[model samples]
Target: MADAAPRLLELAEHALSTPFPLRLRAWDGSEAGPSGAPVLVVRGRRALRRLMWRPGELGLARAWVAGDLDVDGDLYEALDLLSGLFWERGADGSGAGRAETLRDLAAMLRDPATYRLLRSGLALAGPGLPPPPPHEEARRRTGIAHTRRRDKAAVAHHYDVGNDFYELVLGPSMVYSCALWPEPGTTLEQAQYAKLDLVCRKLGLREGRRLLDVGCGWGSMVLHAAEHYGVQATGITLSVEQAAYARKRIADAGLADRIEIRVQDYRDVRDGPYDAISSIGMAEHVGSDRYLEYARTLHALLKPGGRLLNHQIGRRPVRDEQAYRIDEFIDRYVFPDGELAPIGATVSRLEEAGFEVRDVEALREHYARTLRAWVGNLEDRWDDAAAVTTEGRARVWRLYMAASAVSFERNRIGVNQVLAVRAEAGGGSGMPATRSAWLS
Candidate 1:
């Protein structure tokens, strides 16, 4: 089985033409590729078994998450390299040759368990084995999709991991959404601060104004508004860990009197007519079927002529549904039931909810930059992050963030800050005629 590893690569040489200079190391003293190349080590028989059983990106993800396979160098680059093999076309404008690909695949399936599974075309979830803990349980959702109970469960599943882990990834700012890079040299903290303040400015937040932040992560925006803008701020989140950490931070910052953090759902918030609302990075979780409900709820929460700055990730319009494969991996491993609607769809829904769309700004490049910065932070603090969360969870984040960055950069996905206003009875939005007031 070990000797066949090298032979398998040799068979799929066409796919490796422009691949990263990486070495493949098998567990049983067998190696492939250049001597000093970055190592992708198959640590045990399980890696091959997984590949043989599932035989595609899913199998690769499972093996990688289970630590059956590991990467020794630039994790982002290695992921990109592997992804290129499946997506990139050959000189003949087609993918890898069928016969060679099949031969290579067969070489990895020589083991008895893998062979049996391959022949049966069935996946076995065993008792003692427990299906490689992380990969097996990653996709388990708690309740029905988009229900109030299910949404809370999904939010908790993703965000309740640990506040310490989030702090490590998000830096001192503690903002989980996209950060606006003011310039090429700006740091992540700076970008996040800018993004938070930008939302404040867009909403025209002022002293004594009541601000509600839906899906606020760690109360970054809430604290910023309370401290800097002098607004009475309220932040809601499903993650109990986030609420606890945010409350502690608010107290420590001497803003407890002005800011509040609650482990509450958006639908449950009965507090009415806030001067402004900020829903950063939360809209994606409101499934398409419930998107209008989400929009309407926020619209109802705002006072007449009140502003809403909703920042969310959105998908680009695409003809090929297969291009959404990355979303499947994301749903399984990272965000359990998250959905990214297209920008147009999002705007239409908001409009349907009676919001006067004041501004629509696509921050695709900015989100890509933000994600890359996060990926870099996670990589730099790899050991520290692993201590906070499992190595498998960290790997899941690292891979998902890198892939999302690429998607944003390529316009496959996007992030937008949609500025809307609850119009008065006289059809007045009470917004500045031009965006110049908010731009500066």
Candidate 2:
């Protein structure tokens, strides 16, 4: 016991010395009591102790799930602190190497029991839990399908599920994208409302102006825009179920006069020169090859000088092609046929297509918080979720939630919501003075 105390102190000191100052705690007095920070205590030295011998990369994660670790403050903040530790490393120093060491330590801390339970549950859950096919295989399969079918299937497989299923997890507004944490102390709900309002403000929506919501799911933003901003909203979605549910929602909200939901592909959309456009959580489906086409379509649809907001997932800069792989598990279980392009790539496409990039905000940590909340909601309604999609789907979601949590935790994926404006050639115009002014 005496020897364990010094070793634990050394481990804690190592973690603290890193960019992420990790605090340790124990359930029993075996390791010289808690040092006033979060504590992670296991039953004994033989159990999951080896996993924590050094604050390995995933050590804290394994400890949290095994009931061996508890955080005194915010979980997201803890994760942010951990991520900062990894990011504080620069090219000229030894910090980068130490960060790598922490990551290696994290891998060693995996709890076998937790891994086993999660794996077993997913195996029972259904076809959705299949391992992702190789990236080439996925690309080939997608290419074989007609472009329209490919797009529709991609959207349907993700959003055609029962609206009740989403309602169970998402807030009453059913806004599934990352909530914009505008100020430092904003609550989730407030941030979400602010996000919706921010979108509306960016679009410069006004009464009688027609706003197009491409790939709109369940019409949450459509209703919000119409009701709050007095804009006439038309939402297009490839998912019939989503369109149908959104129509009902619109009618129920007594917004049939101002809002409409249509089941149509974005390519087939020719409604008109919309005053504004917003595609939230939809651009991920616009494959890298089709990004240019998407930009052209938006350009053609928007009225001269109109603005468009694109909120989608993006990949960080990868040193080589090897760094990018079609995450098979995500493809097979979560978003079939989805692809995430780098933000730079998307911006290039927009610029080539004649749109000016106005603002870009990375909501990486906010998305982590959003996913965490979703996981908590799913776990809280595990029985109901199991009933809706069967145990296999439930298991698939469980795997997805955990994997996604780790992905964001490790900085593998990011969310960038960009605002771009259509600038007509030969038209004299100045950019907005302050993008932040819209937040006010």
Candidate 3:
């Protein structure tokens, strides 16, 4: 066992040499990498066993979820540091060869503690380790993906976690999507309000107009539109929890008559001919196969000359082999079945569905900023957030949001608000001749 500490240190030294400083601490009190740096604490032997069996991001994620792995110091910084090493390894095709692998095995066998840990890890069953507990794997949605029933389950899995938890993370403003930060240093609430107002202006919402908010999370847009724009707003979502919370919010504002929240799919919304539609932060779930259907559905639901704002996350095709190697950890753990299409695909689908694309704005930086705000909120109110859900679930959000922020910042993904209009029979979109009016 005395030799185990040094052998483990050697393994980390060779396996995880990063450009930036990172400290890896094993459960047996052995340390590797730069001393006094950010600590990646391996809580127990189980973490190593999990990593050995599962491998890659999923293994690391499971270990973190199960509380067998953790980091000391800034979580975001630690993730970034670790990602640098992972990306570097991915860039170099050559991994540990036969000789190096044999050397590691020889060292492990000579050390009682390391040998025991290796034996335990190898004893685990074929392919991968047992799946994480039900709670940890909750994000792995069941049934056919993107169907109404399956989509409902997926939505419920993510949004129905708890309104209180979301409230803490989203703050009082309760806007979940990317916010328009008109100026630097604007608070989340202010930015969210600005974003809502911006959308209203873009859609040209006004009194006597009917607005439909598809996949409206907690009625933020619905309430904002009804109160500020004086539009008769209808918000629909598959999550029963969101509907309940949004309905209460509408009632509390005494705007129940002006705003309606329904737990229904956008496909089922037959009460059509809406004067305007705002599908904020919802289009991502409208799978690639159903994108045209989504565009056509919105087109049919809107009156001629009515505008539709389809806000969604988009991905620029990854040309970097290293980046492309990282699979969709988000789908497995956070937004199951949520698919991000390219902005071009999105615009083309709308055009094919008889929509005249008016404005296409990419708020990639705004989304990164918004996610950072949410991450800050969650970290600040971590105790409350953790209480609302399990620590594992909270960890899931923290990691997912932080990584997503980086992804957005790096142009790996983008959030675009595509404003398209249903042309009248005469082909008039009824749009302003200039973008100046919307800017105001």
Candidate 4:
């Protein structure tokens, strides 16, 4: 069966040459697969070879967990390619596809024997698998924290990684929020700038106007608004590290006079009566129960006829909890105390807070692209990143990339940019109709 390796390589070549065009390297003495492809196969030890041959999603996941399989190209692209093979045709009694794969995986998860076997394999193969950290540890540690302690822990655990690590992956803008991809072929940096501009345009920002950025990270959006749009911007963040970095960045940009970063809670943002407000990637911290309070706080902060743009992650309305293990995983490892409310819920709360919802754009696919870029960046700088953060952090980011790719691809999670207007008292006709009126 020496020819079996050749046959497998041939099959993989065929699959890769198809629409997927996967780049992978087989370390075995298999025929040096396709030529000029990004995928590479390096000769490795016997244990690595055995780990690579294992079938199904669990096997791939385990291989990743054990660091047995490493994709030199884009991890997201690799995931996209592997997603096609997640369910093999004729593997189950039914035909191969998503349905069959999920069915098989579900069955495996449910069966006691299968569960024990998988668990045992994981115990033996996986390295440094520790019990999940207590959820509220961060909140208990940081007194006067608004969000749940577990939630804060999750956010801190994820974001508190060194700033330089995020800088390498996120580029010069350091905008970790979703990008607004205006058109195909848009570079990640261009899309990010466009997203910031889009927010400024939507909010009717103008020179001499005061703008408040709630939960601002590293002052990217606010600084952009101040520099390019001619607005004075103030940013508030819960992260001390982020605030310090943002202050330095503002000073470096010569905008320390025009832009300020405050290490304060969103609830405590008082230097307002601002002309416009933006909360980019911040609403997730407000929790599902506190969304109303969040909306009300924005309403109180804005001046009459001012606009507010809330960019956030949203969950679709669904009763199916079984398919959402990723959410639980995110809560435990990534975000901890975070909760995603459905888009409808967010709109309802906004309306209840007496704001006029002007527009809601679901940038779900754009977020997929954004995350794909981030995962690609992570993979490209994995070694440097590993040096900057803890091993647990690396594992968490790996899982986050894989699960987030699935979530975005399947539309289980969404990114929404909601634009609302704070109606003038006594309610005359709302803000102007022309874009130039705002921009000029």
- lDDT string, candidate 3, 1-440, tens digits: 42333455555544443233567676667766677677888776677666665655676788887787788877767777666555433333333332233235567588786666556445422255455542656544566678998888778778888999999999998888999999998999999999999899999989989999999989999899999989999999999988999999899999999988888898899998999999998998888779899899999999999999888898765334233332445666777788776798899999999999999998999999999999999999999999988898888888889988887876667999999999988998888778896556
| Per-residue lDDT over 1-440 for candidate 2, one digit per residue giving the tens place of the 0 to 100 score | 33443345454444345422445433335444335433334444422342434244333333333334444544444555554555444222233445554445334247564345334323322233222222211233436432888877767666766777777677576887888776778766787788889889888788899899998888989999999999999999888888888999999999999998998888998888998899999888887778899999998998778889999888766555433455544665567777887789888998898888888888888887777777788879988977775555555555466556666767777888888888766752244568766544
Mark the regions of model 3 whose C-alpha exceeds 4 Å error after superposition.
1-21, 35-37, 85-131, 139-143, 319-328
- CA lDDT scores, all candidates in order: 0.78, 0.68, 0.80, 0.69
Native-referenced Cα lDDT, model 3: 0.80
**Against the correct fold, how does model 4 do in TM-score?**
0.71
TM-score of 3: 0.86
What 10-residue stretch in candidate 2 is worst by lDDT? 129-138
- TM-score for all models, in order of appearance: 0.84, 0.68, 0.86, 0.71
Residue 114, model 1: Cα distance from true site in angstroms: 16
Off by over 4 Å in 1: 10-23, 29-39, 85-136, 320-326
**316 in model 4: Cα distance from truth in Å?**
1.4
In candidate 3, position 380 carries an lDDT of 97
Clashing pairs in 1: none
Residue pairs with colliding backbones in model 3 are none
> 147-188 in candidate 4: lDDT tens per residue?
544344555666777898888678787998889888899988
Residue by residue across 63-165, what tens digits does model 1's lDDT show?
8777788888776566665555654322122333332243354554765644553443222121223145463335466656898888887787788889889
lDDT of 1 at 357: 96
